[model samples]
Target: MSADLWKPSAEIKTLQQRAAILRTIREFFCDRDVMEVETPSLSAASVTDVHLASFNTTFVGPGHAGGLPLYLQTSPEFAMKRLLAAGSGAIFQLCKAFRNEEAGKHHNPEFTMLEWYRPGFNEFTLMDEVDELMQLILAVQPAERLTYQQAFQQALGIDPLTASLESLQQLAIQQGFADIAEYETHRDTLLQLLFCMKVEPKIGQNKPCFVYHFPASQAALASICEHDQRVAGRFELYYQNMELANGFNELTNAKEQAKRFNEDNAHRKANNLKEVPMDTRLIAALEHGLGQCAGVALGIDRLVMLATRKETIKEVIAFDVGRA
Candidate 1:
């Protein structure tokens, strides 16, 4: 590629606006007494989510010992949670994260993530805090809160939790996403397609929206709702129909967490993908006890996009994958 291709346009003032917004985020957190923390970007284990591919590399040890395999973290979640288990108080981190096989207008192999955790908080409490944080960051009034089911009902006239896989696929086809039929056997995949194609574009139409109470099957790391076994204590934030963050009332049960991780690996095996090692250390931390807490991971790039009203992530990022 030409060197000129890597340079950003001089008129990209949105980049400067993004930087200012990020500074405001840190200021907000610091004022709230949340300590900024740093964690390793490379780890012995990566997230088990089959859909998120992780980039792997090797590290040399002292005395020229054999290289040890390491994976770039998809998020700072595991290590941060370990710190929480070790009794760290309200903390936040802003860092670059990596994910393999992602490149697009809204995606890059390397991207920024802003993650935070609050002790003694549930999903609802954290949702309120996120709403307030958005107001502060965007310098706007309070945002709206809508449950996941309500968002789906408003957009597609169907319930996400109770809808069958076939019904979701049909809805996708009817809505002009004919490719969704290929994932008929995977309910989660079909639901995601429906949401992305039909539902997301309608969310947060007037302001930021907090969509909570996700289906239990799609809870990547959240705890299942005790009152409703079919749903999980998870939520996602959206603005102008763009997803910005995902939060959860963390599941502190080690056994259940292990089960979920193993199931993810099993799915990987079934799909002939390489099996990733489980983070036994994280499970141990959970067993040792993590205080009642809620955590969230927000896409900094998406936030920058919204703050600048940029159409593509490349416009806001310093350098995207195609240039790098």
Candidate 2:
């Protein structure tokens, strides 16, 4: 490697901006009486979300996890939920998170995440908080709240819920999208393709936007909407063609959660990916009776990119994996 590779990727002023942003974030939470917290970056039980990959390592020592594999924390959700189960109300954390297969203009193998929980809040309430935070940070206009169905309908001229697989596939082909045949059989994958290629780029072009009521299949850990039955209680915050946060109305049913984990592992098996270790502690927490709560995990680096008006995340972060 050249000597220049040792140089920090971010300029001094950008580093200043990052520091200031951190301070502002802490102040934001403090003002709301949300206690700041810290949790482990590694866990014996990793996440089982099929879409997320966790970096694993083996521990070797006496009186400890001898020869046992531990996974880097993908998010602080499980631990935070465990705290909520222990009666810790309204907590937030700004910490390092890891994923195995991620590297791009907006992704890093290791990244910063700002995760928080609000007890007694529903999905809509959390979405409103996210919008308000954007207003506080970016001074942006009031966010446009769009349902997943509405976004798909106006952006792609199809109703996502009622559209058949062939219709979605044909739309993809018509949009000059190539190699979508592999995704044709998967409904969620097709929806993702259309949303990413057609809808997402158009959202938050001029202001922050909140897209909610995701399809049940792609909800991950969110609960299914009681009224709609088909939509999950999930919302994503976006600005300037970038996704900044993912929020969910916490699902407290232990059995349903375990079922989802098993399904996720099965999907991973079908895809030939490693099946992640299930977080039994989190499941136990749910069994212990977690109260109604909604939480969100925001990408701090991406937020910094937006706050600093940087074109790419590399400009705001001190180092990308390539440079590190």
Question: Which has the greatest TM-score?
Answer: 2
lDDT of each: 0.87, 0.90
Q: Candidate 1 residues 268-306, lDDT tens each?
A: 898889999998889999999998899999998888777
Write the residue-wise lDDT of candidate 2 on 157-215 in tens digits. 89998888888788888887758744658778888888987899988889988999999
Superposition error at 316 for model 1 (Å): 1.5
Clashing pairs in 2: none
Evaluate residue 83 in candidate 1 and report its C-alpha lDDT on the 0 to 100 scale. Answer: 95
TM-score of each: 0.94, 0.97
